[model samples]
Target chain A: MFASIMYKEWLKIRWTYLGGAVLGVFIVFEIFLNLGQIIEFNKANSVWNYIIFQKYLFYSDFQFLPAFIGLIVGIAQYFPEIQDKRLKLHLHLPMRENNLLLSMVAIGTVLLIIIYSFLLIGLSLVTLIYFPYEILVSLLNTVLPWIVAGFVIYFIAAALFIEIRWARRILIGVIAFAFVSMFYYYMGYDSFNKAIPVFTIIALSLSLLILLSGYRFKRGTK
Target chain B: MLVKTSRNILILFVIFVLAIFVPDFYWKIFEKNIRAPFVLYSPVIHDFIISKFDDKTMVRMDNEGNLLTRDEYEELEPLFFYRQIVMTGKMPDSLDGMEIDIQELRRNNFSYRIKPDAIEEPFIQLYPLLESKSGRAKLEMPDEFIRLQNRCEFINCESNEVVEDLSETFSKAFTDIGFKFPAAKIFGNPTTRKPFDEGYFITDSAGDLFHLKRVKNKPYLKKVNRPNGVNVKYIVVTENERREFYAILVSEASKIYLISYNDYEFINTPIEDYDYRVHELMMRGNILYRSFTFSSDDMIRMVVTDREYNKIDQYDEEWISRENTSAGKFSKMVFPFTLSIIDAKEPFINFYFLFSDTRALIGIFISLIIAVILYLRKKIKLKFIWIDYIVILLTGIFGLIAVLLVRYEE
Candidate 1:
């Protein structure tokens, strides 16, 4: 049943998932090219000093790509389900309603994890070309929260789309925005190192929220 | 059951967002700005002079509470305002009964400040090892940088490869001095703007301090003797032309010391009560005296000493901090706790939850009553919705908003 549900979701979002992967890799490649150009014009040691002391991020261009991809993939997967009240028909299957809703979100989450992990490896290789493992660690620490935000956005999108009422949807949207923005509140490199665990838990917990919206949709609540 | 748990999670998430933002906006609308006066000790008057903003005007006063004009205030601290006094041709012939030479005053005047944010900031471990004796007219940055991990490895920038010969020489020198591998903390001002390079003051894995510099393309390594019972926390290296000290050492116990050039002696500054994590330390030096001031948001303390580091005079004053203001007290009655992720003391994004005093009981009590009234208005029995009341009792206004927005269904 889970495999069938996963395939159904894949059919709904296959194009979006592939396009997001391409865009993500292209952005990472652009960041790598920009760093090479920056090192070409300036003395490499001076560039390294600026990045070290001034907290300049060479890969800042990749900051918002994950969130953007998550947003699009989420909308692609869930928007059609609500277009003609299609979810009402899908929920009548033999599986439990909660499992059906949670399984849908779990599919999206797994896909995002695969993409985020691949992009992280690509970024690490680029960072190591000119810098050391120490810098790569800080880069990972800094980018971890942003990746979690991508997952949170995806989860919230599912909840928002599946919700039955506009007022509740707007409420959830506002709260989700405020919650997700916390992940990008950067002070410096590796600023979110200590908060990543708590934030990741919160981000994962938001996946359960789709069940409440699904319940409301099932009952046809106002 | 799954639906109920999901609903509760949503409510809790709403409460978390409100706890961080609502009180944050409240303070933004009603916060008071109170600044401490800048205090300085005068060599001529033998007392402290204070300059503060009184409304829209600048007010200058002495420690004895005598008001003075701006020029009179400047004349009192001749050593501090020497440029203005010299331009006005009112420079004193002498101060503290010693003849004052303008050149000596200019050379000896220095000021350095240490803020908690700067001390606790995130920094990359790469450091530039500039040539101390390049014999050039101006200092230039080298083409390589050093990473002191298991060993001191200098990586050439253009090739991104380890310079094996230089690395071997420096690593051997470091190991010969009983220095442990894998440095713990390294501090230095790696810029060509400085007059010279003091290289880096690094702590090894064993927590012992070592000074490493490159002179004539060779390593000059020295193992510094730290004061017994003092563990090093941070060191701010100053490559000043007047190199009386190598760096300012902050001990793990929050005590401040100067790594003096005189046989690497540790000169303790007369700041008996200072926590470098919360208070800011500012040091000013002139030919005759060194002044140390450490202050927080609402309190200021100034200690003046002779050039030989004896505390000759001191001044201390404190006013009501923002948390004690009227608006602050009223906020406690409205918000049970406030949440923030950023701190002025540290450069990190971590939760900083500031809980209110017992006065917050008023807010919680009022929220519970509101929740009960809300349940009654919806024609719901209060006994069935007892968990909603408990949420209100704990989170106060934030929980009230969440419950109202995300009520349980029958």
Candidate 2:
């Protein structure tokens, strides 16, 4: 039952992962435009320039596109269930509600990681044209923050949808986006600096709690 | 059902409080950054034009105390046209009798007869005037000539004559009232000569009263001790050979009085119409003759000063006399360093510090908003998701700790 639910969640998120890949291609194309400028200036040969270009590609507009796709995927995972009132059907199933929630979150998290992996690959291909093995390693280290950011947004979207039961999810999501945007505007990027760690711990704790809730539901059914 | 509702309400309340108060708490912990008063830039006005091209002819005063023409003053302009005027200088011990005579001649357009016997040892002593014992000591001089010398190291003697005369008059009045220099022991240091304490007894040839107190220390002299009315202090006196004019830099130490170049009645007749244009012109044309006055309580009252013109048609008359309190105390307490990294062009690491702190706040707000939306949508279907709560708790705690670590590191 858990496998089936997980498969269903994966089906919901597969397009989002594809969309992220497409977005990654566009980012690489944009990065090439800048690289052309560097090549003209004869500054693209060095590993540092390559690293800088990679950093810009990952951190610039490309970073948000992936996160945005992840958010939509996260929202789409439950929106259909809420719309059809099919969430109540899960209660009738022998499988625990906590198990169902865990499967959904796990699937959502895995989808984001896959999306981020594709983005990393895209960055690697573009960076490989100029960067060496060591610089690629450094660039890989920088990608950790973006990946963490993706997971964070996924978990937050899950939590928000689980907490609020109406179409207001989109509204709440937009408001959340606006609030975060304002903070980013004032504070700058690297919101992951403090936020990523917090999100990690929260996701872990929430996963455990969902499992326990499922266990309780199973016991009640028995 | 009520119990569940209450529990949810309690959870929401806790989240709300954390969301609102956490940022402020974090801000309070790192209040040092917000309160730190860093200097954006130092007031260093380098180049300036003096007058219109037509009237731009430089004037100078010859040795015979006459305003020489532009042709005569051509050779003298370089002597007075300083590439750099060093405001910071060590106080000279004393001025010679000849120097005093020269200063007097430059200031008054008439030379004073200096008797060798009349010359007295010039010293500074601190005198406490207020009952609170918070009075500043003044440096005294025999006459206005000595006073100008004591104020500025013979920089602008002519413009300082008015201030010197005022100090001489006041010092004589104070001395006649049996106001002796407070004992050296009162300052707690006997060997070190406090420049403010030395008062010159200004007496006529027969030692008659010319009530005046010459203040050698520019900072102390710039402070107005009067409860009411304006007090002028001599900043510098320089003899300009190019202009053939003796320029004296003076500033009012009074906070209450506004320094204006409005036409004052000369002998009950309006000397000139109240023209801001001319006042602005005079203020601008005279670059070396600027006044910066502040209140007795250290509030900057005004800075009515001139700046050099960079263009021929441009009249850059910068009279920035702001009545604002000095942020000295706040800056000292919050930002200890005179040269802060915040003013640097690159500020690479500092930028990271500010960015990280701001990002932390953003993260918290974003997480909260997302959580609220999820809670409202019932998408978070984990019935009793203690793990999510614990995760949130841990994240908040860790974020807070990280913020604290950065602040303490600073």
Candidate 3:
């Protein structure tokens, strides 16, 4: 049954994962290419010094790309279920309705993880070419919240896109925005040191939201 | 099983959302701007002068509370606003019986802020030792950065590999100076914008202070002796142009010591009773008076020291925090609790709820009345909904809104 549900989700989201993967890899390549140009044009030591002391970011544009892909993939995966009231048919399936919806979310989450993993490994390899472990590790830590946000937005946007009622949808939208905005709040160098645990819990817990939203949708509460 | 779990998840999500969003919304709409008072030492009156924020006007007064014109205020804090005073052609020829050197005054004038957030932020334990005496016109950044774990390793940037010779050289120099390996803390001003690079102030694993600099591509390591019982907590590297001090070493007890260039000596600054966790230290200096202002959200404590590090005078001021304001007061009648995300002292966001004080009882009473009215208007049964009552008792109007917005899953 889980494999069947996973196959259905795969049918719904294959194009999305493909496009998101292409876009994600393109961004990773661009970030590395930009860093290469910086290393080529400037004194490498001065650039590293500025980054260490002044908190210079050579790949800031990459920060929002992960979350953007998450949102696009989420909408692509879930909007089809709501169209023509298809989720009602989903509720009547032999499997438990909650497990079906949650399975869909799990598949999307796993896909996002796989796609983001490609970028993370690519980024780590590119960073190691010039910088030492201390900086490469710090840079990875700095971007961890953003990647975490990508996974989180997938779950939250799934919940948002599948919610039955407009009023609840708006309320959930506002709440989700406030929740996600916290990831980008402190832009200071290494500012997410202590808050990483809090953010991780919040991001991972986004899966549970599908249960609540699915419950509402199953009841057809408008 | 999923419905049962969904109920708990819904409750958790509701609490998280309400606790983060409600207080933020309240503060956004009601927060008032606070203009804090600034204190400076007046070389003319030889007393501390204060410029106070009085609603709409800037009121200048001495410690005695007599109001004066803007001219008197600027004249009093001449050293602080010396350029303006000099432009006004009302310069004092001599202060404290010594002729003021404008050039010398300009050279030493600098300010710094030491906050708990900055000190508490995590750092990469590696440091680059830029050669101080480069023989060039300006400072040059080093080709490698050193990390001292079990031993010091200078990893070159280009090859992304360790320079074993240079690392061993410094590692031997560090061990020769009796530095315990695996340094506890390291502080350095790594920017070339500073007047000169002073390298780094490292606290060894044994909590001893050591001054490490690279001069002409060789390690100049010195073990600094601390005053007995003055344990170092954090070191702030100040590469100011004047070169009076290399760094300011903060002791565990909040005592500050100036790490002077004079043979790596540490002179204790007169400022005292500062806490590394609470108070933010703001230091401003000129040719005459060195002013230290220790501040928290609740109070401002200013101390002035003469050139010899003698405490000349001290003044303290405080105002009611925003949490006790009229808006905060009114919020107690609306929300049984408010949530705060930012720590103000730390650079992070977390869910923290501040329950309203005694006045929130009014909010609870009003909420119950409204809930009863809603039950009557909707013709719903009067049987108790435990969730509604629980939310109202904890969050008052915010809970009421949550209940109304998220209607019963009948």
Question: Which prediction has the highest DockQ against the true structure?
Answer: 1
**On residues A162-182, what C-alpha lDDT tens digit does candidate 3 reach at each position?**
788788788777877877787
Model 2 lDDT per residue over B281-350, tens place: 1121222223222222111122333222122221112221211223323222221112211212221111
Give the lDDT of residue B47 in candidate 1.
89
Candidate 1's residue-wise lDDT over A22-53, tens digit each? 99999989989999999999999888888888
lDDT of each: 0.90, 0.36, 0.79
DockQ of each: 0.79, 0.01, 0.58
**Tens digit of per-residue lDDT, candidate 3, span B1-410:** 56545554455556677777777777899887776688888888888788877877788998899898999888887777889989999888888887887887778788888888677666666667788998887877778878888787998876778999998888889888888988898888776667677788888889988888888878888888888998888788898877788877888888888878787687767776678688888888988778888887778888899867888898888888887799978877777777666676765555556777788899888887897788678776645356676766766776776677666554
Error of 2 at B248 (Å): 40
What's the true lDDT of residue A18 in model 2? 71
Rank by TM-score, highest first. Answer: 1, 3, 2
Q: lDDT of candidate 3 vs native?
A: 0.79
Worst 10 residues of 3 chain B by lDDT: B3-12
**Per-prediction interface RMSD in Å:** 1.1, 24.8, 2.3
True contacts reproduced, candidate 2: 0.00
Clashing pairs in 3: none
lDDT of 1 at A186: 67
Off by over 4 Å in 3: B240-243, B262-264, B351-355, B368-384
Give per-candidate clash totals: 0, 69, 0
